[model samples]
Target chain A: MQPYNYPSKYLENAVEEFAKLPGIGRRTALRLVLHLLNKPKEEVEQFSATLNEMVQNIHFCSICHNISDNDICSICSSTSRDKTTICVVETIKDVMSIENTMQYKGLYHVLGGVINPMEGVGPADLNIESLVNRLKSNDINEVIMALSATTEGDTTNFYIYKKIKDYNIVVTTLARGVAFGNELEYTDEITLGRALLNRVKFNNSFSVE
Target chain B: MQPYNYPSKYLENAVEEFAKLPGIGRRTALRLVLHLLNKPKEEVEQFSATLNEMVQNIHFCSICHNISDNDICSICSSTSRDKTTICVVETIKDVMSIENTMQYKGLYHVLGGVINPMEGVGPADLNIESLVNRLKSNDINEVIMALSATTEGDTTNFYIYKKIKDYNIVVTTLARGVAFGNELEYTDEITLGRALLNRVKFNNSFSVE
Candidate 1:
């Protein structure tokens, strides 16, 4: 590993900060930092100021735990949204993803994260208690678990199910089957098997009218 | 072109700012901004603060135009560096790339960018005047044009050559060759032809002792 010969301390510090991001490596970080140097001084200042403003002023929705500008998120407060159905998701990104489909209109309950024992995350660390409280007092008819297909996701879903099973509300999980655009021959055996066993009528399968 | 339903204005603004950077798309920008929300608040503050510090305080070397902490960069002020030679490059990143090679110890003259008529960047937009002034005042013995292998690079090199052709100094360009570790079968015609025409002595080809 040959050492970098950065010409200035300020440039080096900026690169190190960018490299701390999730997928940005040192070289990409250096490239991004240098790009900022070429931008207008006011633009760069605005970039930093905006980041600071986000970290300082951003809030988490009290009802759903989604990142928000106020105590309640836009989805949670909207009058037109389906208040009877609640979708349990892992993060705010998932909420946006579901919203992009223009399919689901129900309000969301963000769990912050799933149960991953290896990472020391458990039900207590999530928003499970608040979720249970919401179900206890609200007229919610169904709770849909929209987690990933990983083992951790299953474990989290099972744990949440146990906590809310006694309630009169219906509990369901996202459909597991062959995905659209994926060839049937290339689909994993488990997914293909599930798709076959839970096949919907041909007319109901397609999204086109 | 579906509209994004970002829950918070701050998050949306941050994503827009991150997307403005080179190579970063809107989806990647959202992921990165969410990643920052997970990091400790102090860490996020430090990240923004470092960026602000860089844009406000970083300087360009008065002698070489390279980025520096002071008016005179460390390379220009060093006693052990070879002051009789100058490597003319296009940007600070190029300066670091050459420095990382551990081969060249000469000072650099950053041209900011190559001559590109399409972008309206001309010779006057670069640091050619400062380089000329340095050549006039110093006892330089060689000038290396280490620009890219493009029409713009060649135009810049030829333009610089014309400016200092009468000086008592050697003007050289980097040898064009097939990149190390690249298969010759896949090398492009122009590069392969250049490699053959400009083949180096076998004894001086590699870095191994």
Candidate 2:
């Protein structure tokens, strides 16, 4: 390689690392690298420190599995929220979507991922066991399954519905206002609100108990 | 204020800092912040260490004024490059532009910036004096002015041209193919290649000795 007069190995490595992020291409990565190089040394240092610190500080809360730095997430620990009603979601992004509406006064439980058999993500692969355990231990009255409208999402909802039906807790799914195969993450407030408004109770088919 | 579950003030501060980067809005910044959270503890430490190492390792070359991990840059130290010719540029990005073509095999001198009266950039503001001193001390045959075609760029070129003309050195500009008022960073290869090939010798009133 022709010798680069200005060689910044750290910048080169950091750019390579940044290019691995979703939606960040090579040219954009290079532009970012150049921009970082131009920044005051203190600012660049702070940027890197911030990235590392954020990663080290935040983690999945044990109670709700939502991203948090504490043992229990903010939503899970809050007394203001309806603790008896749990809004279950596939990811933290879905939680944010629901939270943005300022309508969800209920607590949350993140499933971590949807049950996709094709992707080898069965009920066992998700945090479904923990959710079931939480329902058994807590005084949860209603369990709302706010998963995506996809085939996998349906499969996960049914699986969850069968497990929790034995309990007196009312298991409800979001209304069919969401488009078929559309993820809950992409759904807007209006559609999500409609879905929430028209939720139906799911009957337990497997559990005769 | 909403209770942010992620309690580390330093971590939160860093995330806020990274959120200021171009194209990185708040949501994406949160994603990155979460991604860092998922990384192994050692890997997170390594990322921080890398940034600190970069700051400690990199330094500006005293001769060509290019960033390097050494006192003298690789281009300046290399015996293979054309030493008789020095390609003078506004920034390190300009140097990369010329290097990317793989056409120019000469040494370089980075002026840091061009003369912009509006930006308060004058002859003394740039690294012009060092460049002039280099010409006076060395047996330099040609000094190619690869500045932008902006009004400010032209002013800087005129100022540098006068000083270099006093020495018995051939001073040239990077041709008129570059569009008027355009920055060198955006010029395409074909246009830049044609410009380099069609470079005209400066024949101003103040002729070279």
DockQ of candidate 2 (2 decimals) = 0.30
Compute the lDDT of residue B65 as modeled in candidate 2.
Answer: 88
In model 1 chain A, where is the ten-residue run with the lowest total lDDT?
A200-209
Best TM-score among the predictions, by candidate number: 1
lDDT of 1 by residue, B29-121 (tens): 999999999989999899989999999999999999999999999999999999999999999999999999888889899999999999999
Worst 10 residues of 2 chain A by lDDT: A200-209
Cα distance off (Å), candidate 2, residue A153 = 2.9
lDDT of 2: 0.78
Model 1: DockQ against the native?
0.87
Model 2 lDDT tens row, B32-72? 65565656767766766766677667777899988777899
Q: What is the lDDT of residue A155 in candidate 1?
A: 97
Tens-digit lDDT track of model 1 for A1-209: 56688999999999999998989998999999999999888999999999999999999999999999998888889999999999999999999989998889898999999999999998899999999999999999999999998999999999989999999999999989888799987999988888899999988877444
| Native A-B interface contacts kept, per candidate | 0.92, 0.38
Off by over 4 Å in 1: A207-209, B206-209
